[model samples]
Target: MSINVFLFSKSFAQQHTFEVKNGSFVYDGKPIQIHSGEMHYSRVPHEYWRQRLKMIKAMGMNTVTTYVFWNFQETAPGVWNFSGDRDIAKFIKTAQDVGLFVILRPGPYVCAEWEFGGYPWWLQKVPGMHVRTLNQPFLDSCKTYIQHLAAQIKNLQITHGGPIIMVQAENEFGSYVAQRKDIPLEQHKKYALAIKNELVHNGFDVPFFTADATYLFKGGSVEGALPCGNGEDNVDTLKKRVNEFHNGEGPYMVSEFYPGWLDHWGEKFVKVGAKGVVNQTEKYLKNGVSFSYYMIFGGTNFGFTSGANDGDSPIQPDLTSYDYDAPISEAGWATPKFDSLRSLMKKYVTYQIPDVPDAVLVIAINEIKLNKTVDLFNGIVKNIQPVVSDTPKTFEDLNQGFGYVLYRKKFDNAINGTLDLKGLRDYALVYVNGKKVGELNRQVKKFTINIDIPANATLDILVENMGRINYGPNIEKNLKGIISPVMINGKIITGNWNMYKLPFDQVPDLSKQKSSYVAGNPVIYQGAFKLKKVGDTFLDMSNWGKGIVFINGHNLGRYWKVGPQQTLYLPGCWLKKGKNTIQIFEQQNDVKNETISSVTKPVLDKLNLPKE
Candidate 1:
């Protein structure tokens, strides 16, 4: 590899020629560093794209990097959505308009603490399917997705007079674990190379690279491509790791330098503080290295699309707010971290940054009265149709995803003993004859729950998918809603079971219902609030138990009493000016006379992190 390391002179004609040579990025025969920040367009509302970009630029970033969530784009099999938050082209162009370049990481598998590791839930429908390796089904799906995605962004490349200067072939491929134990690491390499081919075949002539943490470069790095590391170390450290593993003769890059870590439901909100972030920022910028801050602006996960983390322990669901404790808050407001970083970056990088934009609008809503309620059983729609099976099946077997499945059976004789759910996927709300009994939670790694079944009584188990394992070897086991049958007293209860698929896209009309039946059972609470002026807010879940919040038919996200996140962010963009409806489906808790409220501040219940 040859290098042309020349200093970029502003007085001279601004050369836009970008290439990798001699361990440095050369622009118009001059060395250039990419001070980039990662922020997903899918997470933020389309209305705030430009404002966030401006915020990123004012923080001394020269470029914006983002992951294209395949699941969010291709919601259903064969059906694609590129409009709204899933619109990638508009986002890239908006970044460009804000005077920043773009780095696109269009992963068929992006393990950014996202649901199903970015794989569409529909992939679970394919029989004998495998993922994240050289599997035919996954490869075919990836190819079709890439082809469709490339068509939308091919002309938008910087080479084609667009803002996207770099492209990542596959995200963290070297860190991949095969779907099957029999598969070899070499198969992973073939899978990555195939994706590289797909990218180049679709006319992406820009520099293509792969990103991995701690310099794991085996399956990810390919011939003629760059290997990048993701961490908080200085320039020399990131460069040394990538160079020793791949090539010392190429430009060094930190693809995902972490400023803050992701949070699980029961874990404390992850924060790196302003001092820690500024200390690292000063070192990397002054040392002539390129880096991208992972999630400089973490947005809301919104809906059941939020995933869980089961890396090597008990299952932990991710909170609704992707706030990340980043410099830019989830509400798009700047924190002290923003102030410190901006002051530090101006001290080093010799570039002009514009003034910081004003913070987003926020408002406090009045306490909402949940006047009406509908029992979950009363609200069951046509899709909850029952399927009688001798042996219980998983959600995929029933062609369902992202919801709860009810399994119930009736016994003639009285049995008083503990019930063993051999293969309960995650969490199951237990009920006896429509009465709440107990719960079996897989988060604590508990599979069995104590129960006393009476004579001629019905036993029902409602299993929910608390997001799919977003990272680690457990990903292949991402089946939800009871993958195996339940056993009690060492006997397989051989009886017909009714399965209700609760894929509640939207809440049904509460007025159509007679009245609230039971409290402990799953119920939907309905309320209305009149907004004189729309503004950002957080729907407080402190008053209720575990459930999701839907405002004006839009699924904001989930919340639980055992939460570090007790509120769901209600972005002003999602709110209308008039009366707005708020609905919540509490799985186990009863909300009778209690009412929910909306606050301006988010409650990252730090006190509850270590407990339940």
Candidate 2:
């Protein structure tokens, strides 16, 4: 490879020009194929970023592709966080240091099975805001996100001696536009152009590409940008489709070659075997078709960052563990899939692949007894002030985005009738007079339960915003909590009600709260386990019910009795060599023994198979 030296800042830098010409990626005037793997910085801990990048390179990947989650960086309107795990610039820089080029996909709307499809939940509050379109309010916000994001990485572009080569426009937009019968093709193209223009306006000076299925190229691709196919491994089909839509053929790339699949709660874990991945990858390598494994190393969702999918099936919320069953496990350990792919890459790539890094140590600890408990109905959490209203309000109405919300109403007169929960976005645990009643789940399509209400009875309905719809048209209407009205029998229960916003932004200090376990109510259980040495481990949640877990104050994400994902990936880096604390906000399931064990391996495939 020829070196291009240029004077950068106060020092001479090795700046190389990257371009797509004559069907190939030409770096410094030499044609080369991109061997890329996708991994998101927002998904993995920042402490393990460098090691993960190194693993990607070791697997014979020369390029690292990532989606810059708009929601991850900007949690609220005008609020941006690029430091720590939200640091995309550092991630790209680290990839370059590990001898890998970068393909940046900064989606103001990236449906990576991420929360709200990588969109800030607050966007729903903007009047007349329609996402993935030319809606002015939405576009205005997109521009702001782009400007702030560009400020962090514009200097890191390949032209500026950085690793970023190609920047992706709106992700899989064709899928969204193709289904809309009311919208014209021309209007869709204009919408795409607007996003592409925003990228250019913010100084993202690089070759831009739009990724979609073959049929979506026309609707998803911008005029000046390259159109890349996703989830298509057949080289001939890929070429034909590109030529048919793009009017020019040659350099073909599969933006998302899935080695594994995403998992949703209450469903069987999706697994793409290593043999299948190897076969498809070998074909791509032999045909000189560039590709990026959708997830080379699927990490933990680590909080309420997981999204949901609602296609032909019922609304399926994604599990907290984004293990993806890929080459690397969620705990950052190598697997047979990784080994097989590494060997295959060594056979095809002319360049020398680096040696695989040493696997991170994983330790298993004995059962940790949860001795202290705090009731949610009590005063464990003192931050959330109740919003009093006549009717139940949604999470958005209360200025809250994620987490659970409690709706309480006291009836003065006794009534025997069916209690109907109207417009419950996701899941809810029903309680009357501080006693557990029946439950309502949006996933199971349960909306009403028969209840015998006594005089002076307090009805408490705690609803959880499982996750927003990350895909399809329904995302526009995703509002958590009771969106409409609660009814008894045939009449609306209209009166005074208190709605508490429990966003759980951080695990509250519950040490001062009473330490007694309350049955059938949402409670915070606390425990401690001492370790001589620290390493990666999985916390088994089979003994407990649905809730989020926090270790040493770091939110490890949600876990439910709903099988498929029974263990949560606990990183060793987050633990110390002494007493470590664990707190679980379990909402249901009366605990016989408040105990959980740290296991070495994850039990992700075990599904709660339905009975006839």
| Highest lDDT scorer | 2
Residue-level lDDT of model 1, residues 388-436, one tens digit each, is 8887778888877777788878889877677888588788889888888
Tens-digit lDDT track for model 2 on 235-290? 88899987776667667889899999988888888888899899999998888788
Per-residue lDDT, model 2, residue 547, is: 92
Instruction: Indicate the worst ten consecutive residues by lDDT in candidate 1.
Output: 1-10
Per-model clash counts, in order, read 4, 1
At residue 554, candidate 1 shows an lDDT of 84
RMSD of each: 3.4, 2.5
Please, what is the TM-score per model? 0.94, 0.96
In candidate 2, which residue pairs get closer than 3 Å at backbone N, Cα or C atoms, i.e. clash? 23-251
